[model samples]
Each structure stands twice: as structure tokens, then as C-alpha cells.
Target: MIHEIAPHVLDNQFKIQDPKPNDYCLVYNGSKSLLKKEGNGYALPTVAEIQKLGFEDFEGHYLLNIDERAFFLLAVAEDYAAPEGYEFTGNRAFRPMAPVERLGGATAAHIAHWEALNKFCGKCGNVTIRGEKERSIICPKCGNVVYPRISPVVIIAVRNGDKLLMAHNIDNPNPMLFLISGFVEVGESLEQAAHREVMEEAGVKIKNLKYFGSQPWPFSDSLIAGWTAELDGDDTIHMQAEELSEALWVKREDIPPYATDVSISCCLIENFRTGFTLPET
Candidate 1:
């Protein structure tokens, strides 16, 4: 849903181009992004703008463009002091902005993480450089190439006649419940991952699994595949204490709305609450 910015095209094709002064600059310090304070919130700073504030030669790696406007992921220092009228905010801050900016911030964040994590070659312990022909990094010593990683995840809504399974993970800061979801492990299909995740976390089997939809979850560096399934056996939830803080079946009417619908997990839960049926899937 976050990437559904209609009429705002994203040109992700990699090209060799240096950042211009007016082009948008994306800078991050770990999990927080550096942005100039806008009217009520914040906006991305440009190369010229950051340079004017004493960050000289403020160039960055060229990322994709949105609607012909270019974006560069800037290399920033570790110790950050926000200039007047500027601040660094977490990823959630991008959610409330207009769709175009929202997508920009999230996409930039994803690339930033990829760039930060893969500073050297896995095959050879040599410093890597950006690949010119693609969105990847290359090690000169070994000629090893590394592309941005996109991990696959599965999110499923398991339903009985009148109730839907819900869970609050142990690591989640917000206590709001979510559908059964987890990363797809090695040697597993999306379907197998779905089944295993449900059983491991909720101690239940599922039937009538149907493809719901998918979303690019940039916040977690995951591409979430959504699914809908029916409970196969008992309704009693033998919750996995190590994985979840709470897991239970909530009646359709009792399932509360999630704070945002920008995720596939939220869509799965909302579909169950609305009594959706599988269309011959």
C-alpha cells in the first residue's frame, strides 16, 4: 500500500550519474533519517542545501528517480548534530506524509540499509564499490558482486466461522495484534512457510489457503505475501511463548482496526473481519 502512489512513477533502473545540487538527497544515521524541518514535519534535504550548511562536497550514491526527479543516498558522518530547522526521524514518521514522499523515504531507507550492511565482499574480505551496470556492489580484488537483498515473508489470516486468529509478537512495541506472519526459511515454498509459521506460533493447521495480495514492506526490508486460510482443527490457541506475548482468536466483531493499512498483515486481518470468501483459489 505504501508503494501504491498512482500517477507517480518510480524509475528504479540504475544509471551512472552524479547528484546535482537540486536533486533530492537521502541521508540516514542508522534507523533515523536526516531531514530538514518542514512546516509541520520534515522534508528531504538537497546536496546544495546540506553543503550550504557546512557539509561540503555532499554527494551520495545515485538511487532511482521518481517522476523524473532524482534521489541520491548521501554518505553522512556518525556523530550528527541537526542544523537549526532540521532533525532526524524514524521510519514511522514517513507514513503520514503524501504518498510520493512516503514512498521516496521508504525506498531510500531500504537502499540505505542495503548499502550500509554490504560494505565489503562476502566471498572476499575486500572493500566493495558500487556496480556501474546494475544496482549492486562489486569487490575489485575478487570481482564479487552483491545486489540489494529482498527477503520474502508470509502473512496469513486464519479464520474459523466467526473468529480470526490474532497475535502480538514479543518484540513488537505496540501491543496491537496481528495475523500469523514470519520469514520464509531456506528450502521452503511460500505455502510451506505459511503452514509452518501457523503451526509453530499458534499450534494449528489451516485449510482453504487463498492468495490474498502482496506489499513491499520497505520498513522491514521484506516483500510480504498475504494469504487467507481457514482453521482446520481446534480453536484453542496454544501460543508460542518464546515468539509471541499474546495469541488468541478474536470474534469478527471484536477485531479492532489497525492503526494503518499500509501493510499486507493489516489487510489480511481487515479482510477476515469483513467476511471475505475465497474466489475458487
Candidate 2:
């Protein structure tokens, strides 16, 4: 199972006190900037300078919240370039690097996001400074607190033997099929959330519910809780047009090549496709 690197971890306790001057700080204009190693101190490139550089060679590293526990890593494209330059490649070469390298980008991105969002103190309407022992900013005036946010979501793959249930998103760009998935409601447990999503998205009840692993889905800061469920009644799928363009059963061999290959959804589906199962949850 995957859990996001909580932002609170980056609070003062986890920060590198003697960080190298050339350490990288992930910057964002529209996309993200190249991993710029820190110099003398943490220097955020000016917007003008970022504009001058255009968009290139950059990737999203991660997200940071004011609290130490609200952090997540992501890979974003730095598609900018400076004028008259040799067309910087940003960090495309490293965009799909190993998870370990990507981890650094995530940390930098999270911290940068936290710092940028905390420029002013909401409580005192005064200036805020980054706390040395935590990831939050301290207001010199009145004391109020802020933190990063995380949205929990469920992604499940419904299986009945060698066949799998899949759906095409009602609002997708391509006609790729996807598993039933959705966000958890305010007052729902993870299991309840999964069942609710399956029912709402596919109009089918599930049984033999088993908790699968998890993945840090940073596209919109989602923690994907993966699961496998047994289809109820007939294999016939009743599509929810508001939520899906189409829904159907597909044989494992007929599964289309994934559009976004790096997702827990794919992982869960593939596991079932290959007859792999974890210790029954």
C-alpha cells in the first residue's frame, strides 16, 4: 500500500539545517521549474526571470502544506525556455526518473508550495516567516495556524474470474477504459467509500471486498486506495451517463493499453488480469 509523504514531515524537524547551498528548490510559474539547487540561501527565481526562461526542462516535484504532515510528490513538466537560448530541455530526462530521485522533487515542490502559500499570516494579517522547526510559517502578530490539505479517494477494480469491469469516463479526452473510482465523502469510512463509488459509478453491488495496496496520486493530490470487488448479479453493466461515457466487461487479453500507465488503478487491474492476489484483507 502507498501513503503520501505527509507534509508535516518537512516541518522544521525534517528540514536539513546545513543544506548544501546548491540544493534544488522546485519553482512554479504555470508548470514547475528545473530543480535549482539552493545557493547561499533559498532563492526563489523572480517571475520575470521565470518568464524569461520560458517553460522547459522542469517537472513537478511534490506539494507542501504549512503543516509538517501534508506533503506529496509529483512529476510536472518544465516546458519553458529562455529567449535566444539553445532551447533548454528542462529536466525531461529526469522527469521519469526512479522513485527515489522523484522523491527529491516531491520534497522540494512541497516545501516551495508551503512557502509561497504562507507569505502572509491569516490570523494576524501580518507577515509570516518559515518556522525553523516545522514546515509552517509563524506570524509575528496574532497566532493562527494553517496546513496543507489532502483529499482521500477510492479506486477499485471489480473482478469476476478472468473478466474485469471497466468504464470510460464521461469527460475523458481519449476513449480509454478506466476502473470505477471516486473520492471519499466527508463521513464515509474507506471501505464504505469504495462500495459507494462502485455503486454510484457502475450501479452494481460488490462482494468479497478486499483491501488492496495504495498509491500516492498527486495529479490533484489524491491518495488512491486500491481494491478488488466481485460483481453482483449478471455481468451486464448499467452505465451512469453522468459519470461514464460507456461501461462493459473486458477479458484480460482484450484490455487496452493503458493511457496513463503509472497508476494504482492499472496496478490493481493488472494484478487481477494476471491472477495475483494478496493475503485476503
Candidate 3:
């Protein structure tokens, strides 16, 4: 959903291009992004402004090429202070902005996290360098290559007649309800993960597993594959106390308000509420 930027293209080719003055520069300190407040909103700085602020020494990666201009992600030192009239905010705050801005901010944050975690080779203790032909870091000594880490997760909406299953994650500080979701474990297919997550979290077996869709959730470097499944046996929910605080089924009229179009979880719930069926796979 967030990655579905129509009209505007996102080119992720690993080309060694210099930053132009007008190109967008995403400056990050730790996990927070720098944004200059403009009237009632915020805006990212240009390459020229970033250079003027003495952050030009930091190495930046080519994040995206959109509308003939490139976007670069720069990881600044934690001690770096924001210029006057600018403030640092977490990536979540960027979601309410325009589509291009929201996508750019998320992409920049993900790239920054990847770059910070892979400064040195995991196999050898030597420092790693960016790959010339691909989006990866290479180790000279051990020859180990590291790419951006994306953990695959399955988010499923369990259906039983006119009711949809939902749960509140115990680990989340926010009380927003969500569908059953979990990371895809080793040696498991997407469908298998979907079934396992539902059973683990809600203690229910699911049938008629249908592939819904997917979304690139950059908040924690996750690619969420969405699915819809029917209750196999019992309708009673045995909530996993460790993972979920509560679990319940809700009809279309009683479903709670949730996420925007930026997430596949929202799409899944909306589809079920509208009685829309996915095309045969």
C-alpha cells in the first residue's frame, strides 16, 4: 500500500550519481529524521541546504530516483543538532504527509537503519564497502555480502461467516486492534506462516487460505504478505496471552476504525467489510 505510488515512479537502481542541489536530502540522527517546519507542516531539506549546514561530510546512499531527481539518505552523527527552525521527528510522524514525502521518508529511514547495522563485516572484523553494481555491502577479507535485511511477515484476516477475527497485541503500547500477524520462520512458506500465526495467536485452525496482497512496512524492515482464511473448526478464540491481550470476532458493522490505505492490513479488513471477494488465484 505505501509502496503503491502511482504516477510517481521509484527507481532503486544502484547507480553512482552525485547529489544535485535541488535533490531531496533526508538527514537522519539515530532513528529520527530532520524536518524544517514550514507554516503548519514540515519539509525535508535540499542537498544545498544540507551541505550548507556542514553535514556534507556524511556519506549518503542513493535512495530513489523520482521525476528525474534523486533522493539521498544521509545518516548524521547523533550529536548533530538541527538548524534553527528545524526539528527531529521519528519516521512515524512522516506518514501524514504527501504520498511522495511519506514514501521517501520511510525509504530513507530503512536505508539508514541498514547502513548503521552493517558498518563492519559480520564474517570478518574488517570494515565493509558499498557494492558497485548492487545494493549491498561487501567484505574484503571474508568476502561476505550484506544486503538490506527485510523480514517476511504474514498478516491474515480470519473469517467465519459474516464475522472477522481481530486481536490486540500485548506488546504494543497502543491499543489499536489488528489481524493475526507474525514473522515467517525458517523453512516455512508464506501460506504455512499464515496458518501458524493464526493458530499461535488465536488458537484456531484456518481454511480456504487466499492470498490477499502485500505491503512494504518499513517501520521495522518488514514485508507484510496479507492473506484471508476461514475458521476451520471452532469459533471460540483462545487468545495467546503472551502475544495478544484480547481476541474477538466482529461483524462488518461492528468492526473498529483502523489504519489508512498505506497498509495491507487495512485493505484486508475493508475487503471483508464490503463483502468483496478476491479473484480466483
Top candidate when judged by lDDT against the true structure: 3
Worst ten in a row by lDDT for model 2: 85-94
Cα lDDT tens digits, model 1, 8-69, are 89888889777788878878776578888888887888878877878686657788788877
What's the lDDT for all of these models?
0.84, 0.58, 0.84
| Tens digits of per-residue lDDT for model 2, 27-136 | 44334434333332222332234334542333322233233222232223345442342222233322354343344444444444445567688766788755555555
- What's the distance in Å from true for residue 112, model 2? 4.1
RMSD of every candidate to native, in Å, equals 2.1, 8.3, 2.1
lDDT (tens digit, per residue) of candidate 3 on 1-281: 78888898888777888788888888878768888788887888888888888765646667778767788988778898888988988777667777887787788788877887888999888999889888888998899999999999999999999999988888766676778999999999999999989988888999999888788988778899999999999887889999888899988888866666588888888888888898885
Alpha carbon deviation, residue 16, candidate 1 (Å) = 2.5
Where does candidate 2 stray beyond 4 Å?
Answer: 1-13, 18-22, 30-98, 110-128, 137-140, 170-175, 256-261
Q: Stretches of candidate 1 above 4 Å error? A: 18-22, 38-41, 258-261
Distance (Å) between predicted and true CA of 239, model 3?
1.5
Each model's TM-score, in the order given? 0.91, 0.66, 0.92
